[model samples]
Target: MSLSPFRSALAASTLLAGFCAAPAFAQHERMSVIANGEKVGFVDVARTGNHVAVQYDVKNNGRGPTMVEAIELGADGLPVSWTLDGKATFGGDVHERFLRTATKAEWSDSMGARTATVRGTGLYIGQAASPWALGLYARALLKAPASTLTALPGGQVHLDKLGPATIGNVSYQAYAISGIDLSPDLILLDDKNALFAVLDTGGAVVREGHDADVPALADLATKLTAKRYAALQKRFAHTVDAPVRIRNVRVFDPVSGKRGEPVSVVFANGRISGIQPLDAVASPSEALIDGQGGTLMAGLHDMHAHISLESAILYIAAGVTEVRDMGNDNAFLPDLMRRIASGEVAGPRIMPDGFLEGRSPYSARLGIVADSEAKALEAVRWYAARGYWQIKIYNSMNPAWVPAIAKEAHALGLTVTGHIPAFTNADAMIGAGYDEVTHINQLMLGWVLDPKEDTRTPLRLTAMKRTATLDLASPRVQATIDRMVAGGIAHDPTAVTLELLMLSRNGVASPSVAEYIDHLPIGLQRRRRQAIAPIASSADAAGYDGAMAKVKQTLKLLHDRGIRLLPGTDDQTGLSVHRELEIYAEAGIPIPDVLRMATLGPEQYMGRDQELGSIARGKIADFILLPGDPTKDLSELHRISMVVKDGTIYFPSEIYPAFGVKPFVAAPKMTLPAPTPKLAGSGPAHDAMDEFVY
Candidate 1:
């Protein structure tokens, strides 16, 4: 996953590559990182003698703590050395070091040792360079005239000048820096080529004096990225193609947890129209495509997605066709949904979930922040008026006020789900009218914590170590389970998060990501191998193992009691959801049941079963065609041949390259009629596998 604002600030400062700025006199340049008008962190830039230095310091209180980075550039404005020493989102110890010389560059990061030869004037550095590096890199690119430069650890960096932009009263020259993922990270420069501001996907970084201008600048950045993705969607989505009929595929029955007999499924105009016997021949007018005896199943629903347009595309490419956004920047989520709905971008259908939290210094800064019961009710009415299907409470919320908040939300027809507030337990929230609990940790933490322990800190996570010895049959645990069962309370365990937190050890590749990490961009792949929680000794490792086992045991018990389990990845998008399902399977839930939880379970919970979550005729044509049956081995879901979302086709092979990922499979070969009309692009114009654009 792309780091959160605080992690992004501490992780890598140089997300944009190849751009260089003009040399400036020795001075300090301070930029404050702001999210939703709240200051989360800051980056400091300075040039002393012949070296350019950048430093970042931020403590997101409950979120990202102990994030610090130091970077130094050579006289040529290229990185000479850099290090990011901090804790990852799940509290992993991050110690990334990079050193460069004239002939070679060396790096020791989360993924271990890596080296690359010096090619031309290109600098091989870690991705953590500062925004100031953009202008300096631009200056270098202007002189060299190269489209891409190789990074030391691996991957190509593409840079482009987007001309000029004027935010508020200030004028600026704009440039886009991207490395894989088609992320057009736009950084703005003043007339003197000084790094004035950087607008990333969700938030922004502006000079300290310009803190108030973050919203406007971030909006501009969001639009530029949107336009870039819009062009990509237009170029890749296939809407004008002939009706597609996929024949000779086994359909997965979520109801029965088995694959039905081979069948022919045909759909167009965004709705399934027919399901014929596998032996039936397609009409001459229909475009017949061979499934090669693959399995066809409904596209998945990510019940706890904190969505972004980029993640949305990744989800669709990974066969997750629907998402229910758990929490996000109030300003960003609505517009992103609007773009997706208008077909200006390619993504899964989104169900917006309003995030409600109490105002506190350690509060998660997204969503509506309320300080009193009246304000909480006001937030509920606001979300209801705007059509939010559900409201999610957060850690800093007052336990005493949850009843009133839940009552107002329920009265307005919104389902209530969220973290059990600090100093409270799952049973208290369930009794207060919460219909669901958000995470497995939230449900289990109460059984282990003292009444005074505050969850608004890392203690909420670290306290999980105590769960290793928890007794599920004890009155304390059984009471919560009994209440949840009787109240029809659903659980969005986000089990992969627990696995990442408790089971991952430093230097040992996490099993949850080992299967697909290598397929991601180098930056992400490297980060995935790092531990989330440091294991100090054999006892610590054993504690982690025991803690993870208890959580798995909790999941199994909840399922046995008929408490609904909704599979969701609260971590990164795409393959993480796949891994979440695998965690479920490891918890002893059958493969078919896991698949059902990802597909039909959330749909039924959200009350959208009539229009989605199935492959029957009249349902929305949202499903994936995989090369193997997932019923036998859930891993087959990763081998997606094609994903049809709302009747539009997307090929993972074509989309992967945009993000610097090697395609997992060859684009499906298609049989077309004579005089094949070519797509407007150059590389391969034969419409490989009928590649479509939105």
Candidate 2:
């Protein structure tokens, strides 16, 4: 149905008449906010006179307190004013506000102020708007062309009506909204165009009276998003019909930890078929490529990534072909894996990690949360049956329960890894059966935190300052490292993850991402430079600097002691991996060793060494072509010219543009070489080259 301006006018007049007079009949809608099948918050909507008002209060899953957002909408349904005021994810402050005027709009948040010219009836979408205002936005977009909208201060939103779904005995039309940076969100409205529910793969805001329908509704939301992204997968993936050949490439040999001499590689059926010297002859039918004598290394692996479609694409564009998804929305992760496997989307091969958190008010809400040891064990078993590579325990988990959970996970053949539970130390976890530890902070916080400090709060991130003063040579610190070395515990320090938390200062660009800052969106570049943990005094700044320095020192110690380190990015996808390796190099690890740790180490840990981790004959064709030798300069890893995953070709230039990222190089176009001239003093050019193949 087209948006009838006259009908909207009539509806506005009717709402004014009814709501202004009776007030109690002010078209109200309310929903219970749910995550992990638990009710943590609620959303209330009310429209009166020529205005619509919505109030949302939800204690998000894990570490997120009760966050509150309020929106006041004008008669045209555009936001007149919006304010998000509360701590949500990771205890980040949620003081965001947007005000729209007749000719302009302005917004202010932790990132600072943004102003944009308003044309016609402009809209304002706050960061907290997803899964809450999606319904309201859907209703407003009925009048928009192509159900498309240009978001305020910049960006765009493309909305799609995904037919109808029934929740709680009521038939409602569902719509999917994309282009929000986060995952696609699903919105539902009743026949009368009344907001019914807003849902995502993890949680939902549904009508208060129909609380039992949230799960099914949440499932519907996941399927709807999957369907949408599957369509995108078809559009983005590129596959070749003929055998492909790449000539003149110096391949990185993970086993040798060095770049080999220039060679030509031929691959088909998603496996490397042969590796010949650069002058090797190629058939006319082969899809030939000139590598320009750059480095071709095994596709990189990120051991500690939180997966998302955008992040997956970004990873591939940066030459990362595989990822170990640390924690995510339970239903969404499996569905995403299916999409990538089926060639419905372009993404890295995912190795799943089951996330288990303890039930506490401050619990981080990404995965399953257990309230008891038995429940935690059950969660572990649940993941084991589904083939999870590891089980990650998080804050809020009872430290006492770690032994039982880890024991069962180990018995079932899953590695146990996680943050040091709140009020617990790494010594206890390592003793209990932790095979790996994630995040450098989670590993070191136990030494710095007061016994009663709750990691479920910001203290986990802020307590690192004490590390600056920590004496690692002391028995107390050395014992922890000793235990890790003795127990063979692997560490994914994610040192780069702490850089922003510790070193980022107000108004200063991140020294870490300075080389590629211009390639990102302005808002992101601004936000990236902002401090995550504010430094209140010079002492605090010094403390943070000391803490960061100490982290590198600890990393060097771990490396020197033969403690395995897995390179992973808990930050942005592709570039963050580069930054992670860069930090690894700064931590005194040689560039070759860092590359080996990033590529071969994780593969060996995952037990895929026989088939992966290098560019060799008969191995999977997953590798990236860089513009320069990464072993000579680790920074060259950031400039991925092309990526080949399962024999599907993707150019960073082509993929970057889709995500608004400026490509670092042009797409590699295949050019059949001219017939080889007679080799000087040689019987045949091909004869000399074939001698090196064996």
Candidate 3:
């Protein structure tokens, strides 16, 4: 231990020589290149009985030299551990992490997750969120998401529906998805190929569809392939270019009144590249409007929408630009969001909320109700861990448990909003720290003003004079408003549903009805119409209608009283969301204000200012162009002829535009001659293409 000077010098000299040689050795690291451009190099831990038979695909991108790396094996020659080797054949690390998945036993048992390695393609397993990936590999492998990526130029990547697979120790089923892109978290791609894109922000994932192609889209993609595709390789690069111009339009500035003058809106590099002076921002890239004046405004936004792929089509067809889904179901929320963002699904931008609800034995679809503060905190943390935008509270939550829930949600940076229990009104909920209240009906159900007004029984409560409609002008209403102001609680007062609830059984008549309903396709119309009947003039129906109307008016009154009203439609589809805007107008709210509700209100509520809401510079390109000015008549909302959700233009009118393929020829009504000689070809398997006669 004492005489070490000479010994230390020799040891240091040996270590220095090793360090210098290490870099040189790493430069020649031996590795094997399997398929898909994956080069794994690693040392052999052990060897098998027979020849080392390794099967893998080779992906040659027509560039880059072939690289060979060590591919570690598991039991039965499966591609288990993989690493990029440096220096020698069985060398040092070269920066590659192949997560080992778990067995299926863990998944089937108590653990909700399991991981297993995929044999053919390592990619299917590597694309999962880390935890899920880890859980999967260490556990079992079931199915892998389909690896095919198809597109209409620039679109989103969805978890293609996949079939099942079996690992050595476990089995699983890979859930499909639409879109996934997250930052700051490892994507866990398990053996089942479940991928969770832990997003850095809450944004809609939208997609276009299998409809006819847009010529302009072709022009754009083909035109900018190089610069744009490079951007594509980067997650947050500026991906789309603004078209030359938008022609022939009416304009509705959310700040402007209805029946306002026409104006042109122009966009460039994802901004109001230009709002042309008063008229249309006409350019050769776009077509001019041929009809008389119509309404033009920013596209509508649905605060809450759910699972239907049809909902996305309905939203686009109806011109709803954005949709904020309130709950998750069917593994649908994430996939739906991704698809929308990817342009794989023709739909609106989606904002998703991990399901939240009162903890109950009856788990209603997405119900996750909680009875304790600790549970609420845990729930918030769990959702935040996933990529949910907000904490959507639900009905039947215990009043006493609200404050604890609110505290936990706020701590985790989630906005809490939903139904308040009957026993506790808006004041109690907000004072307890609720950030927002959804649906206006709940606001008026309180018994504060008329303390002795037989509040318990439904009949008694209905008969009471202190209904929300009455309380709107009372001190109690203002008090609630003051408290909301103090607590900064916003209201997602859905106008259309409330109006429909009021006009519940009016034989479904009204000219404005078509103004809203016309946006929907015939099939959707047929379905909604079916819900209209078996009409009977019963007092119960009358009272329900009255209460509904009162609720609508009550919401309007709240709006009148300076409460920031967010336009929300608990519509499963986008059809009703746009209608809600018009309904808000019918209730005497200004047309400009209606636009603001869909734009500014919810944006403010989510506290996502830098990226969303206004059609301003630097905000994510999410807006619509109208053919007419909606400020004149809310019906003009129907004029959303073009939409740019997430900067990609979705022109509905031209989605299936004629490509000069064929013209319709009306059949002759006269009795046709029977069987014109079975086509003289002697029927030798004639080709359908050969049948054409110009």
Candidate 4:
């Protein structure tokens, strides 16, 4: 929603109360206006020279409050200003929805720019400043828009006008329909209300009835809306949190920093109220299950996940309780959120972001296709309504747009984080308004290094040399870090992402690259995995080692400052996270702390310590039983005996990531006979080809 109102008619007086930006002395007064045999509303004016302000309001003569969604006006009649935003709801009427402008009305003039939250209800018709004024309210209204076009009786493109009508107290108009997707789709119309773009969606149908806005056209609107709010209804049902109890388990609590202990855990009414010794179990009415002496720990969180049924199911199966979805199609988000929360589907809790792009080649591929500052602001609002938790400003956004979008996101209670291109670095974004800077490279690029460039990079030989050592002790680097600390900026140090970025070894993805390819969806496993396959023909092992040096320096700097490091792996499958822990050790995080980084560090960042992030009395039952303590043989984590997420159990180690219809349980892992012969480490064994690190 932009700061301006839908029309010049409403802008004068709205938002004037105590607004520092509003002009002074713009107060309401008595005024008269007559039309259609009744008085509606009029503007009260005050002016000093060229600047003037007006105050006004519309009074409903009808039983309900007259609702208005838009008021467009501007010089040359181009609707230079509009405040059409946010959907409208009147009391108990559920089907009513509203749209003020074709898109969120982003405001600008020869002057400058500002953002708005389009806030409205009911059917709204006509062009900007149409001279047609009406109040809307409703009793019985639409049920759902017709969303499935395939099942409809018949349709040769139909053109019908819907309203100047009312059902209780709302209005709407419908016209020119062709190619309504089987799933409910959105059709972008120009001011003439003629279709400009038809967008496919898994949307709920619009509820409708015959009335004035366009009686003959009412049925057409109904036909246009079809799909079952299947996605939404499914999501809404799953949000229920059932009571769970886990008894007799050794717990590893992150906050308490405790491990290797047995405890009885109880969860009821969605909160962990107690944790006692395994022998001290108390009776409670909830879903109680015995942990059977297995180790219990905090729920694992994946920093990045793309929403898909298979992926979501796998997240829960893998013991990941929550995930942060970096970016996805904005239009699909609202219903997606509803479905996830309703528990209509089984998946980890998700946090989504709306795409924010600049004038880059990748713009339209995501929802970021924007050109100007105003366009960028509208993109933010467009996603804001759909439930994106943050503004994921992408790699190609203009440096200037970063500050503007960040400010708007803050104002809207949204955080800004993501990759900014070479044009804008982390320091400037943080100084401007970035709340969190993502990826270790961005963090490093700000103070540590110029970064290892690719074939397209234009670099100076001297700068390349500086990329080796991050002068953490340097005053300049410390100063920037100090500000980041003072500002409470969270660093999602995905060390694995950096490993991939740095490991262009002969262009093979990495030594571990081919391993993850099997975990991908069969239909897409090859196509998608091929793009990132090992960097064969790429640079050699030396480049990887150089990158590791900065990564190590980054670790020391973050450790010294006591900065908050979110253990996130851009690695989708949670297994990659363990690999990340190993890499964390390589980058120099002591193994114990690195383990904590995965188990507890994330919970504290989530601010849900009371309910999650460890194995202890009264904690949610989440933890994995490893073949051995990860503190000793860090690789033991790979040999998980059992994994419990929210108390549901799964065992995947025996499966060994083989791409199968299902992970097989051929037999539980068994202890092998005593080791046989040993070989000298001074000589190359298994794959001498893999010993490039030396």
Predicted model with the maximum TM-score: 1
Candidate 3: residue 527 lDDT (0-100): 24
Task: Compute the lDDT of residue 394 as modeled in candidate 4.
Answer: 61
Q: What TM-score does prediction 3 earn? A: 0.54
Give the distance in Å from residue 399's predicted Cα in candidate 1 to where it truly belongs. 0.9
My TM-score estimates for the predictions, one after another, are: 0.92, 0.85, 0.54, 0.54
Query: lDDT-based ranking, best first?
Result: 1, 2, 4, 3
Q: For each candidate, how many residue pairs have backbone atoms clashing (under 3 Å)?
A: 21, 7, 77, 73
Q: Which is the winner by TM-score between candidate 2 and candidate 3?
A: 2
Clashes of 4: 73
| Number of the candidate with higher TM-score, 1 or 3 | 1
Q: What are the per-residue Cα lDDT tens digits for candidate 3 across 1-694?
A: 0011111101000000000010111112111222111221111112243212222211111111111233433443333444322211111112223334433111110112334433332322221111212222211222333432221111222332233322222343323222221101112222434321111111110011211222222222222322222232232112233243444445444554443444445555555555565554354333122213444445667886653443455566556777777764424456556655665556666777755555443222252445676776677788887767777776545667778777877777777877655356778888888788876656666533333332222222233222423646668777887787677677877656544434433224332244544333222222222212112346544655556556656666767777787777766445466677776776777777877887756666667755666654455666655544555565555545555666555554433111101111111111111222345676544222212111
RMSD of 1: 4.5
Candidate 4 residue lDDT tens string, 209-276:
21122222222323332222333223222111345445666666454445666676665544455776
Q: lDDT value for candidate 1?
A: 0.75
- Highest lDDT model number: 1
Give the Cα RMSD of candidate 2. Answer: 8.1
Estimate, for each residue in 563-618, the C-alpha lDDT of model 2 and write its tens digit.
99998877544778888898989889888899998888889999998888898899
Global lDDT of model 4: 0.45
Give the alpha carbon lDDT tens digit for every residue of 548-658 in model 1: 899899999999999999888875457778888988888898898899998888788888999888799989989888888788888877788788899887788878778
| Candidate 2 TM-score to native | 0.85
